[model samples]
Target chain A: MVRLSLAMILCLLMVTSGCGKAPSESSSKIKSQDPASVQNKGTIGFSALTLTNPFFKVIADNMQEEAAKHGYELIVLSAERDVKKQADHVDEFLVKGVSAIILNPCDSNGIGPAIKKANDKGVPVFTNDIKYDGDEGKVVCHVATDNYQGGKLAGEAMVKLLGDSGGKVAILHFPQAESCQLRVKGFHEIVNAHNGKTKNAKIEVVATLDGGGVRDEGFKGTKDVIESNPDLAAIFAINDPSALGARAALEAAGKADQVTIIAFDGQQIGKQAILEGKILCDPIQFPDQIGKVTIEQIIKYFNGDDVKTEILIPSKLHYKEDAEKDPLLKG
Target chain B: MIFMLLLLVILFSVLTVKQQHPTGANAGDQVGKTILAQYGKGARVLVVTRDTEEDRGFAQAAIDRLKAAGADVLGQVNGSAIDARKTIESILAEGQTIDAIAANDVTAKWTVYDRFPSVGSAKCVTPKPYMWPNFLKLSNLMSVANQTAIYAIIAIGMTMVIITAGIDLSVGSLVALASVSSAIFIRDYCGGTEASVTMVVLGAFVGIGICAAAGAFNGLMVTAFQIPPFIVTLGMMMMASGLSFRLAEGRSIPELPSAFFWLGRGQTFGLPNPVLLMIVLYLLAHFVMSRMVFGRYIYSIGGNEEAARLSGVPVKRVLLAVYMICGALAGLGGIMLTSQLSAGDPKFGLMYELEVIAAVVVGGTSLMGGQGKIFGTLIGAFIIAVIKNGMNLTDVDPFNQKIVLGAVLTAAVLIDRLKRHA
Candidate 1:
């Protein structure tokens, strides 16, 4: 147990050190373009949806590192999914006279006045992960993962696993989430297209159950579906937690190998699940890239460059092979 | 409670010491003076400012001072870094060399000057930033009051309800209901964006009236049916939240007229409208609690309901009024929130009932219902706001902030319990 703990610590240290240099190096490489403006720029304020989520945390960390390289300070605050709190953070940012402001808006529409406030102050507002589509405030740029494409990738992974002889499938869905909806839509498009191409071996979606985008709900939904349909071919979960939950339910029902799972969000746990052969694979989002790109846009905006209104970072499929190479998971 | 509020104010003020950038006319005039000193008469100057009212004031002052002092005003960029970049590009293209760029402090931070080699950032003249605590800034103080006004206003009703030995968990949901109702009233009945001032005011009253009805229902249940206030309010909380979602179709209503924003965002006498409204409501509530017959009856019922009835006090009516007032104020909070955020969301007022109750309790108001002060609740609300703002200014960890807030609430309650025991 002691050895395992030590090994984990070492692995974590390696991962942190490896990641710490990446954003700075890349930012420096970008800074090579404008070597003249290398002195102290100013401060950038970021209010995240919640830092409790490792996704937002990663984004904040990468942004801080990247901003430091370009001689800027990043002040991060967690809004805890409260729009009022996020608005207050924006107000505080304005009060502090920040050079730029970034937000993962708690409410796309409710956050409009706060964005308008920043815009009025001439502080550039950027968003990531959560896009603000309100008509009131102007967002200089938005950087986020392409959830639809990630979903399509998940669907393609489904086909690759069972394209030869497809059977019955179930979907663990969270319809309320816009990103999840896009994922399911992309998955459906790909699966339906695959079915249309081959008549003999068709994948039939027998059950589409609400998993609440959470592990406990996913576990219960999977258990109920397994009881009704014992010959289920596969399950497509909108995210990692639900996928892992489905795997646990399948194992509990003594049908681990009988069913396969394809998930989105290659969170550390999801990768570990793939490495352990509990879940198949995941289409991962690049929160790190989102953070880096957001800072890049802010720098360019300050540098008198016209930035794109929206930037979508592409998601990558992570199989067991990629998980094995991950330093955080290595002994 | 006032001491607590004062202490927090001082603490946050000290912690938030930062460089305060100058804007508006005076700073612009200062920058103009500096430009004149460095570059003598007829020095070509480009006036750069953000397109805000304050920045425009700065630009006006700078342009006036520079032109009056015989310096040539090349042009002005009343917009973004990109706009300033374009203006400078055009200026350079016109074969005109700028002796200086007159801009406000915020405008001076823009790295757009780096793009212009001849007119580097050094050529820009801005008023020097003064060192000051952010907490003490008039703008920050106004914002703190404005944000706290919602909780402070709602706490008045909560304080009265608790004073009468009753609780209202439904105020939070009522806030949402009111927000949704007002937004829908303006959008569907009144002409949304084209809504008149009279119609907008009427829409706000409509929102408050609905919550008042709900509050009246809560009072009826407690007074007539003899149900516990906690149980009744808990049930109402769920029902109102669900009803609001149903009415709103689970989406926020952002179609209200810009004039409607005056209540939440407008200022009077250099103070936020909500803060002014909170001050007025607190004054009225204090009067009712201290000088009025209704206030006396409320105290009697809270102190001893059976004894109050024996003493010819109208217990039921007072109770009903108290609940209704609580609901109405919560509705007002919802309206203020809608105006502040410029949207009426069913998700508005999330956990606000608890927040107001906390303020009431923290302000040294006993939950046992017979002893509390209206002003105490105000101080309590400010205390919470100060802590939150101070924590944000200090860059405290978000998770740790929750722990700190939890500790403060616990400590306040514990102190209350100990004081009661003593």
Candidate 2:
């Protein structure tokens, strides 16, 4: 038995050691490129919350374009919605000696230590889309949509669609996200304000279900809401995925035309739904613009220009009429 | 097993070919240029990825795109984020400018910060502490331990089934059913002003009873009809999953009472309640499997069913009892998981059976019959959890992590075979 155990340990050591050698040997073979022959532009590292969300991907694409235009290299990393991975990505950026780090935090509070580390290293960390709940000085600037304003826009669109005589409405919400919460608050405040002033047009929110900002959860939440409130007039979804899911649920329930759906995050699917007349309108946050402005701010910081601490990009309301006309709304 | 490994390699390589080599021949340069335009001109780009064929294809595609855009393309390196950092360091040591790096997001994140000198204006990403301020490390350890404990609880029951020369594929589904049923019962019946700890305990018992009954049914069918355990458990698995969905009505049951939540999320003596429960269960299982007559009978039956029967062992009743115990454990795991999430999600415990079985097999438990230890299964459960947590901490891509885990599992079994031969 002892001999067998020793032999097994030996085999295990051999396999691990063999696996370790291949990477190091390949790394050794890498020769430096001739500096005299090639132009050396600066590199910028960007850590996105997730590329699975087309919204974040669009922002990343825009950042890449802006970086290229400025004769700079942009390295993009996806955090896949993991706070720890995002923290690690920031560390990688610090190691690469990149000029600046652009962060899209998966969790605002969870990214504090990582941002603090970047601050300690003297690396300027810029936030995009989502703000980090860390030391204020640690993050140089935050570029994101005015989510509350977007939600108010959604509210106004719903009111306009319903006219003076407002009916029952349901909300598919993601309460966990700060941005989503702001959106919901803005929406509720607007509708309540409208209701207080105008007695004839009363917009009563009949059901509010947690959609969790995903297709499956949104579908389930919407289905349950529909089962309880059959006479629901309109549904406001926090994001495109939830809106699409709500649309699916409505169609499955055979109440497709009965409810007017308004959504946020004017993604391609949401725009398609608008054009198809399934959804009334969508508040479009310009992810590409957010990305472009983020890089521009980094360049400003590099050029010794004073940068703004907070930049709010306004969201545009896109209805069916604007789907084909507006470049941003077009898929 | 070798053939399976070869097939996976070939399949991944084929997938790599499809992803790398675009079908549009005439528009290749146009497409490449468009893709490369995002990175801009005069940037020296390095691509780092795993040594797998798939990653190689991605690297090659990136190189082709960068070259078409008139950028100085640094050669591709095959390794993890740390190795990529080393390669970048080597290049930098020779005074080459690294303008940009292109790799999968996870790898790029790790490689981008290699040897970042802390200039007056520069910052550093803090290295996570391992030993000091033991609280942080302990918390992380506890999180991983808690996860392992849940899997270990289920796997302990699976170990019993495997020892008796049987398998229970329905454990995962049973977990979902138990979670959903208990949550629904607690919320609908035992909820509101009259809610009490007794009610919560009763709800748990009812849920566990349902699971035990389902397990008893599986055992009876296996013994009475002389059907294979695999087929019977497979059927039960589907049936239970469907029932869970039907009962849940496709929505998660939330807002369980605090007492119920304590069973999953509470802590005792600085350890998670689930972990404490897991340790206690392991002790009980150890006693049952090692010190009891039932445990011996299980081993005897697994060693040779015909001989055990000839020796007057009641094989059918033991098999029946074994499955019931497995079911009850699965129910316990379900309740714990549901409590942890603070909801009874119909989607809970998805594909958990495969993980449980893998843990059992990796713990040196022979599938052919008995010959396993409860302590070994506990170790196996921790091994899987640690690997998962380590990979997440290291920023390994989720896709590549799967490959690494599979390789580790295969290597473990291969080493076991080698040891046996020796």
Candidate 3:
């Protein structure tokens, strides 16, 4: 009896919720698109790792525009880093009879079965940013930034900055992400090689702590390293957010002028920071390019063309000079 | 709760109505029949379809029907558009004129025919799509059930725990611990993919055993030392989560034996293993909660612990058993999730503690103590699952989906409060 009353109240409230669903054309009808509008080749479904991050939102927006130009519609959904929820999205895409499915897999291994399910249904799967490392599923193509190359650029910047006078350095790392691991690895290789040649100007390696690739951890980690190494010359953070976090930590400790921070991922904020001389420089990634190129590959796959299994977009280093002339940061 | 579930069913069904494309042998038969009616018997036909289970059925049925109708079936290409293009190019080179191209909706939409004007999409006959709610589809329904099975399984234990004025926040972390430990056991000790079924089963038990130990520790803290259940389980949650990450070295253990996959992915009696397991566990839980003496003791303690203790009820024992059972079921849920996703990662059960607790609260389970049914939790699980599934089907904004879920949970609690007052 209690449940019945609960049901009645819920019905009244949720009815409005259901009705407020935006009217979208009943898609994936299998029939040809209406002869009036652009004959949509097919709908493409994208299950992003998450859309809360502007990084993925950029990719989704670009993909939508690019797909529309090619006469295809894009249905973008965020899995919020839940592999099971991503799997459910794949199932829905399959039931909708979409042309292709794309994802930034939450878990490289755990998302295997979900991709495999799409493969069984004859729908091709593509990945961006995060690669599916598991062997169970087949992804037609993966489009992502070259993180290692970006890290190498960061290393070059570091060597240029601290190679003249040897100074102590700390690393704020996010080890869980494979991309970050590659970045740190590349950074280490360059630093080690630079140290091998110049003993007089050796940049002594200092504390390496996990920054969780986010602001709070980055701030805390930076605080810890500065306390231990008061003469810390520089901090190399994996991404823009963490770099900003390190800046905050340094400011809090009144050592903002003492430590130079080099971060990867030249997002708008990061570029603005470089312009303001907060960060030294950053290796910028083109999320827009990743999104556009992914659509091109999807077109090629459906157009009876051989598509490359992996496409890596290289990152470029941006200095304060470039940030001054950057179009994206102007407004 | 059942009435709410039924209403949700009707709500989603009405909202998600759309044209569903025909597939399988029936789709093939429809296409073949259309071809026969168009060009009549003695017509030469070519078939094109992608390589999939449904396409396979469609190809077989279409070929069978065309041949039975005395139509001259040419060649069938069951693969990508490239394969179809290759076949069509060769057929043209061989001077074979195709009268009709039998295809499904997917193949019919292909642009391969545009290259050969003589054999264009105009000559293709596809099965007509029928209007139906996507929610009502058998596959979608099964997926909803399969998706909810893990949560429902854990909710059974949570129901009991919540009934005793206690919360078990560690269930989510215990799930991850079980998944990673069980996976690691199989990969390292059982020879990975080459392990026998027995070895894999043993690995799973090892995973469960560790979580059970954690739960017992929680029970010990709560009963022996007089700690709050919240604080005890909360501490356990972090420790279990940290331990899993340390054991896994912050990487997913994907090298588990295939024999272990049967627990999560395999189906029994046409239902997924997790869903079937949920049903069986719920029945057992229902029996124990209502029909057993120990069940009465639990209720007596929850109803009034000091009074029940004076009346000779073993309060401490019952509470300890409840926490242990909660932990064990969480372990089971972890294993089931590992099987379902085909790998166990430290990232598997993020935020699942709140999800389960929401299920318990929505099922009319009171946080104050000693009320709620085993079956009520099941309905609550289904309610959450249906909302999620419906939102996905309707293409409602994912952000809005979160808002709706929060609203539903809040409403359920509010309604429960109102009912008590009334």
Candidate 4:
């Protein structure tokens, strides 16, 4: 009975609080700008699934710098590796009436409702780095590096580094992302191709580890591979961070120079390593270009033009010498 | 001794887990970079003893000097010297690398490892401490206190149930369901109008009370039907989870009306309403446990069920009420969570059951039943929250945070066990 009474009181508080006050005529305070009078010149919001990763931070900075040239406000909000929080940020943008949104989804599926809401409200939305797997027609446009092609490049690079006698190669992949899966698939396509081409050095995939898309996991997974197979001739990492982590582990095991390491998404660290000849090769994806193109697509959507739903950005292979000289590959 | 041994085993497992980094220099550098980004660039943080009063301004001045040079600075103090020691030890243990240490008090003890830059050894006379934003500081404190309160309310009921030699795992799920249901009713049905206020309150209570009935169902199954508490609550846990998912309609319901939001989000006399509600619930539970005839019966049943039955105590009815109380408190926690999030995602309370149980067990509540206190669980809950929040502020690796939490949980249980033997 006491519990019931307290529950009743709590309910009463909630009800009274809801009725506490109306929005003080603020709804009428700012009259809606006419569609003809709408001048799109203000802060541009970048909402990421998570800003915890260094890759995302780089993307955000590039976008922020580019947006500054147009006198645009760049509000970067990190979802702290949470899909719900990312969704919340989307809602916040809609309420705040942002000019445009650039999203890096935590999960392709979870952002569906939020993306739909923004589209219905006539807010142009663009996605970069990661593409949604759901109906591609729903989002305005997506700009991302071909993860599958990059993975195949890494695989081909590894096979070449291993020479004619294909030795054991380990694959470290992120389990949740389709992009990561595609990278592994591409790598296998190349590695399997080399199996028929190479005689003595046939690349054998000894083990595959799920790195969970974290550097620490990559390090641990690399160690696990080494421990399980001491003669791992090469390692194909899903991304640059994981490749670096794997290299760190290999260095610890005193086999850094012996095993050729290859990574995707040629991030700064990966580029630096490539310049220093630490990695065999890393595929360079212009994240900044992806960001810029995403905004351009959003703008096109806002202009009432039928925008192409898909935008695939090709990746270039970054060897030690190429990354050393190319300033674009530096970051 | 056994409890200590178990704690030692857990600690050893965590510490000896094959470290991937050989030199650990690179990992340490990465961790430092992460810390710098999280806190800010070139941040000089001072972890001090709680006993040091704010009047000692030298350290504050030193921190200020560092900050003026484009460095971010932060300081932390806990309840006591022992706590300070534990906090530092946990940080070092998790960090696995120390760049520097600065101290004056007992410098002779740990100064040997202070190979990094040492600021000073002289103790300051007056410490002009920094102040946090009123809202943020209050919110942090309230979060800890509110978390404790929720655990306390549930612990009181749990203690009662245990005293009657009973247990309830279904409480966590029931809490989630009740909170979600009440939030929906308030936001959707009531819609924050003056006339709907009474109805909203009634809706919340009715929602929670129905959950209590679910607990009563568990009690009835356990006592009347002669099933064990473990089996009964476990099954109810699944049932409650299914019910919540069905109610949420497979999507998060957000932007709850201000009235519903106020229930959990508002502040009363500078304390979060949830914290206040927890306190009120605690007082009522304390009264029911300490003063009521049913409370006596619960204790009697725990002391010896057969004897209590022979002694004319209504063991079954008391057990029923005890489980009902546990369910009701969980409902309250769920409601607060709903209010805080201003949304119901069916998945909001995932893995919460483990944390709640950890708090209860660490608080001295016996898994075997018939031993614990509401107050103990309250402290345990606060400790967990502090450790988590501190880890976040200190920029501990997410993986290391998990390891540290597991260690602390083990240590708490060990401490509880020692007290029991003593």
Where in model 2 is the C-alpha error above 4 Å?
A1-152, A155-263, A271-280, A285-315, A319-331, B1-143, B180-203, B226-273, B300-312, B338-348, B410-422
**What DockQ would candidate 1 receive versus the native complex?**
0.27
lDDT order, best first, reads 3, 1, 2, 4
Task: For model 3 chain B, give the 10-residue run with minimal summed lDDT.
Answer: B105-114
Per-model chain A TM: 0.87, 0.86, 0.91, 0.80
On the 0 to 100 scale, the lDDT of residue B263 in model 3 is 90
Query: Per-residue alpha-carbon lDDT of model 1 for B207-260, expressed as tens digits?
Result: 999999999999999999999999999999999999999999877888989999
lDDT of 2 by residue, B228-263 (tens): 999999999999999998998865676476687798
What DockQ does candidate 4 score?
0.02
Q: Model 3 segments beyond 4 Å from truth? A: A1-20, A26-38, A162-170, A188-209, A224-232, A253-255, A327-331, B42-44, B68-74, B92-99, B115-119
Instruction: Rate residue A331 of model 4 by lDDT.
Output: 42
Better model by TM-score: candidate 2 vs candidate 3: 3
Candidate whose lDDT is highest: 3
Candidate 3 vs 4: which has more lDDT: 3
The DockQ-based CAPRI class assigned to model 3 is medium
- Candidate 2 shows a clash count of 14
Q: List the candidate numbers ranked by TM-score, top first.
A: 3, 1, 2, 4
Model 4 chain B weakest lDDT span, ten residues long: B15-24
Q: What is candidate 1's CA lDDT for residue A303?
A: 75
Residue B336 alpha-carbon offset, candidate 4, angstroms: 14
Q: In model 4, where do residues sit more than 4 Å from their true spots?
A: A1-43, A68-72, A135-137, A326-331, B1-422
**Higher DockQ: candidate 1 or 3?**
3
- Give per-residue CA lDDT, model 4, range B58-140, as digits (tens): 23444444455565434443222334345445555555432233232222122122222233222111121232321134334
| Model 3: how far residue A202 lies from native, Å | 5.3
